[model samples]
Target: MIVIPTRLKSTRFENKILCDIFGVPMFIATANVAKKVDDVLIAVDDEKVLKIANDYGFKAVMTKTTHESGTDRINEAVSKMGLKDSEVIINLQADEPFFEGLNLTKFKEFAMEQILNQDAFMASAYKYIEKSEADNPNLVKVVVDENSTALYFSRSKIPFDREPYNDYKGHIGIYAYSVKTLMEFCDFSQSKLEKTEKLEQLRALSNGKKISMLKMESKSIGIDTKEDLEKALKVFKKVNND
Candidate 1:
């Protein structure tokens, strides 16, 4: 199941999810696009968001307003829905409307393949980072071993080099895992690295949960700040015209 965990109190762009994109609410646009591949649900924190979601003709679930992270909200939604242990859950951000979802189709295959050989239960994707974005803390960086197993995820530039850096991978904000593993990860305490970097994925990595990383090409336009939203609007117009 594809789930979007959204809330109203956005730090950078207040109520960004409700902002219009392509003539509709950003979250609704995201869900409508995702529905082309499969059914989608929105886990929201407030009645306003829930009402908006339902008005958009999408399934909505109300979660605790006190949740620390979106993942925690997703975990609670999964439990509330009573999903099967083997059911796959994808957390696609409500603000990302252009994510190339074809890549996600392979997550189950890759995860199962890794499970047979390693301890991988969670999976995510990354893309090559631009030179300018390499030093940007807003874009998370990831370094992986030869096997494509994530070595670390950080807000700072990773794999610091003495010479000119050659390659950098920016972490995407989407994740895929079974309902069971999703809950397990939520129960784990925030790790030291997680606290320092403020990245929840580190909590799973710190607790010995293997996260398999997939290389992806297509990406979504993320709306974080007003400038980003403006860029997204232009992109939306271009996409619509195309």
Candidate 2:
């Protein structure tokens, strides 16, 4: 199952999830994209979000507005649904309106491959970033070990670029996890690194959760500011017009 953790409040953009994209709300647009993957649900904290989900005929679960992170909300939402400990779940961030549903469909295959290995219950993805994206603080970067395991995630550029090297990968904010690990994630306090980098994936790495990351081609833009929304609007128009 794929669950989208949604909230009405956004520090960067006011009511971002509820913001209109073309015609639909950003979160509602994202839900339509994700619904093509498999069983999808919106894990919402606000009554307005729940109502929007219902209006769109999408399944939703009410979670606490107090959840510090989407992962926490996900744990609560799934727990309410009585999912099995071993159930696989994919988390699709609600602000990602431009994300391709096809990428998520393919993600399930890649994530399933990693989960079968037993060495990892969490899996994510990233793609090589252009130099222009390196300076963008909103684009989270990642460094992976030789085994494709996540070493670190940061809003700042990673690896320090000590030499003639390049090849930075920006993390796509999607994650797949086993229900057991999902529940365990809620019990963890925010790690020092997580607080410093402002990247929640650090909490998992700091706690020794092996996260396997698959490298894929980059696509879509995460809406952090109005500029990103405008770019997405143009992209949406071109795609639809084509």
Candidate 3:
């Protein structure tokens, strides 16, 4: 099951989820993409969001607004859904209106492969960062181990190129987890590095969870502000034309 965690309050943009890009609310766009998967639900914290989900004829559940992060809200939703411990759960971000269906299908395929190997506790997507994005702190960078496991995630550029570094990968917000692992993550408290870096995935890494990252060729524009929304609108129109 894929769970989209959405909140009405956004520090960067007021009522970001409610903001329309191409005549539909941002979260609705996200939900529309996610509904293509086998099972999808919007885990919302506000009545307004729930109403919006129902209006769109999508499955949704109201959760407590006190969740500290999207992962927390997803965990609560999973419990309410009575998912089995072995069920797979994908965490899709509500702001990602531009996520393509092919990319999502690839993500699910990668996750199923990892589950068959019985080594990955969680999985997420990453793509090679363009040189232009290296300086943008909003584009989080990651350092990976030889096995393609994440070593660290930071808002700052990693592996400081003392020697003209030309390559790095940017972390995407999507995540997939086994139901058992998701419950375990909820039981554990946030780690120190997670708090300092303000990156929630660090908590899983610090706790010794192995997260496999699938390299994707496609990239989606995340809507965080009015400027980003405009850019996404343009992309949406272009895709619609195509």
Q: What local distance difference test score does each model get? A: 0.83, 0.86, 0.86
Residue 43 accuracy (lDDT) in model 2 = 96
lDDT of 3 by residue, 1-242 (tens): 88999988877787898887677998998888888875789999899889889999988999998887889899998899887888888898999988888899889888877754667988988889876787777778888888889888998888788898777899888898888888888888999988887778998999998899988887598876788888778877898899
Specify the highest-TM-score model's number. Answer: 2
lDDT of 2 at 150: 94
Off by over 4 Å in 2: none
Which is superior by TM-score, 1 or 2? 2
Query: How far out, in Å, is residue 24 in model 3?
Result: 1.1
**TM-score of each candidate structure, all chains considered together:** 0.93, 0.96, 0.95
How does model 2 score by TM-score? 0.96
Models, CA RMSD each: 1.9, 1.2, 1.3
lDDT of 1 at 193: 90
Candidate 1, residue 121: the lDDT equals: 72
Going through the candidates in order, what is the number of backbone clashes in each? 0, 0, 0
Off by over 4 Å in 3: none
Native-vs-model 2 lDDT?
Answer: 0.86
Q: What is the full ranking by TM-score, best candidate first?
A: 2, 3, 1
> Which residue pairs show backbone clashes in model 1?
none
